[model samples]
Target: MTGDGPGVTLAESGEFAVIDRLVAGRRQPPWVPLGPGDDAAVIACPDGRTVVSTDMLVEDRHFRLDWSSPHDVGRKAIAQNAADIEAMGGRATAFVVGFAAPGHTITAHAVDLADGMWHEADLMGAGIVGGDLVSGPQWVVSVTALGDLGGRTPVRRNGARPGDVVALIGDLGRSHAGYELWRNGIEQFDELRRRHLVPHPPYGQGEVAARTGATSMTDVSDGLLADLGHIASASEVSVDVSLDLLAADLDAVAAAGAVVNADVRQWVLGGGEDHALVATFPTDPPPGWRRIGRVLDHPGSQPRVTVDRVPWHGTAGWESFRVD
Candidate 1:
């Protein structure tokens, strides 16, 4: 798309000028001793270690310009990366972004994208520390999230035991439902459609689960079964998710499913990008977490994830190289 009115294009304003506009008038959190405008950023790691994760989003593949605004795309990029840190039982403190777009793109769109990143970062009291901007064939957003563990041990995916309770904190299937709605060109279910554009991960709940003695944890960025399979494989355990426990989630998307002529169960089980935190706990999960399943011994059996003790035969989750 071409620029209009007084808003300049990236090619017109040049890279440095555009970067200045993106960083101006933004406040960084106190933990971020130094923010943008430097060769690198300085963050405080009081616990002597830092949690880091990175994710990249490509235009039209991860998102669509027609389906999502630049701001929404920015938020999605930061949210997904931040969720990874949270899954490690830490709180995100800072983020560094790498943004690339065509020279013909509007500068205001880039500013809007930065605004969305800041908006989500502020939700967890994190700061946008530093980043780079460049010209590319399409919009590409890459974010690196830095987190603090607050003296708690990092919760890994291999710690789950046979008796651990599988629990989750955040909604499931909404983003997938939204994607279907958007794909079908249905304008209804505005909330689901919006959720597909921007995910609302339980930000501080990761540290809460860690404090509650969670054995293992991961964010449901790829479908529930696919992500749970990660925990199962790592812990060398079999995970059986109960459909009875997921009735509410199924019900939540039933209407949208009908509108799109899709299966709500598949959405809840195999759909991804919701970014919900799923964990296995030895004791009762944190207050907001919902119990969905349990871990089992994997003696002589392959590490796998099942629903109600049955193997699921559907699209497991997103794969990077899959050709549809």
Candidate 2:
């Protein structure tokens, strides 16, 4: 996809030029004492404890060039890493990136990716402090995010107690619906298609949940049931998700479901990549959070997650090792 016509390839621009293009004209947040053009960036953690998380996205496996633009891929990469920090009840402060792509790729695309990263980072008042660029056969975006807890306790999956209120903030199943539409070559549902490309993670709700006394917290990177299963197992408690509580989420995707002739429940339950926050609260959840389920004591030795008290046999989440 490389040619002349006002665009230079990475091979033509050279590695240094490509890196310069990515780092140019970008501003850093106050938390970053030093940004690019140095050995490494120095970041400040306000609460003295740093929350760190990292994620990697591969071309074709995690996204398709035909389906997502470089900008969309960049946003997805940064957003997912940010969600990891949010799941730990922290707010992202600084980000370091490592990007690799074919030498034939256009340099402008790499710049676009950086712009997208900066755009997403700026949403939560964070910044891209530093990153590296390299040559590879296919595009790979890796990000390491650092966060600050603001003196709140770091919430974990094992802290969900029986009788805690299980709640969700952000969205569910929209990404799966978008994936279905894209995979089937459907042209309708523009919103769902866009959601598949760029997820909308709840920006500050992690700290809000923490401040409100969340017992357990996690981002729904996999299927809802699969992620909740983590909480259930870690906390050794059964989780019962009420369908009546999820009616709004179900209705939100009902039209897309009918068009694809697929059950929306599976999309909401089994689909992943929405990056929504789900947590168990000891009391009432804060504003904008939806009450979806409740934590319960395990009847036996094993703890599990159920939908309306019934086992879900469909796909529960994304399995990276499974061959599609």
Candidate 3:
């Protein structure tokens, strides 16, 4: 499809001018020492340790222009990266973006993408401090998020103990349901389809968990079981997720499952990109998070992740360079 107006393709506007159009007039937070128009941004970290994570979304692999607009792609990129910082039990402070796209792409689409990025960042009370724009064969959006510790120690994946309880906050299976709806061309579940375009992460909840003495934490960017497997291996503990506890999550997407002839349980078990927060707590989980499992004291022979005492057979998580 052609651009919005002026027929200004990448060849006509060039990279720098397109970036100027994209970043112009965007507001940044006070913690951002330096905003866009620089090589990199400088952000304040009063607590000493900064939490950072990066993710790359390649066109056709991560998203399709036909299935999602540029605006949706931008929001998804920022949301996913922000969730990583949240998983570290930190608050997102700022973000830096690296974007590559075909030289023939419309300048208007690029600007719209940046608009969506800024909008999502504002929701988290963060800033898109800096970014780079370059030409490539297709769109490749990479985002790196920096976060603040807020004087609380970062909750890591390896910190779970034997008796800790597993908890989850945020809806599961929605994005996967959306994907199924889109793939099957089913238009019934608008909410699920929209969720696939832009995820709504549980903002500020990560820092809350950190302050509340959470032991281990991770974002559900990958499938639930796959992500818990990371914690299990790192903490040298076994995790058992109860299907009964997850029935609510399954029921939430049950309608969409029926439309596509897919299993709701598979979506809840294997869906990724929901950006939900999962943590291990020593006591009862705080409000807004539901207890789904418990940590076990097994060593070498413990199951990485299990559902109702059985090993789950669905796909686990996402990877960059996989043929499957």
In the range 1-324, model 1's lDDT, one tens digit per residue, is 333336679998888888888888999988888888889989999999999999999998999999999999989999999999999999999999998899989888898899999999989999999999999999999999999999999999999999899999999999999999999999999999999999999999999999999999999999999999999999999999999999889999999998878889999999999999999999999898999999998889899998888899988888898997
How much is 151 displaced in model 2, in angstroms?
Answer: 1.2
Of 1 and 3, the candidate ahead on lDDT is 1
Task: Quote each prediction's TM-score.
Answer: 0.98, 0.97, 0.96
Compose the digit string of candidate 3's lDDT tens values, residues 1-324. Answer: 233466578777877677777777888889877888876678899888798999999999889999889999999999999999999989899998999988788888888788889888989999998888888999999999999988888899999998899999998899999998988888787889999999999999998889888999999988898899999999988898998999889999988888778878889988999989999999999998999999887766864788887788878776657688
Ranking by lDDT: 1, 2, 3
CA-lDDT, candidates in order: 0.93, 0.92, 0.88
Off by over 4 Å in 2: 1-5
Model 3, residue 145: distance off in Å is 0.5
Q: Candidate 3: minimum summed lDDT over ten consecutive residues — where?
A: 1-10
TM-score of 3: 0.96
Per-residue lDDT for 233-320 in model 2, tens only? 9999999999889888899999999999999999998889999999999899999999999999997668999989888888889988
Model 3 stretches astray by more than 4 angstroms? 1-6
lDDT of 3 at 82: 92
Structure candidate 3, residue pairs in collision: none
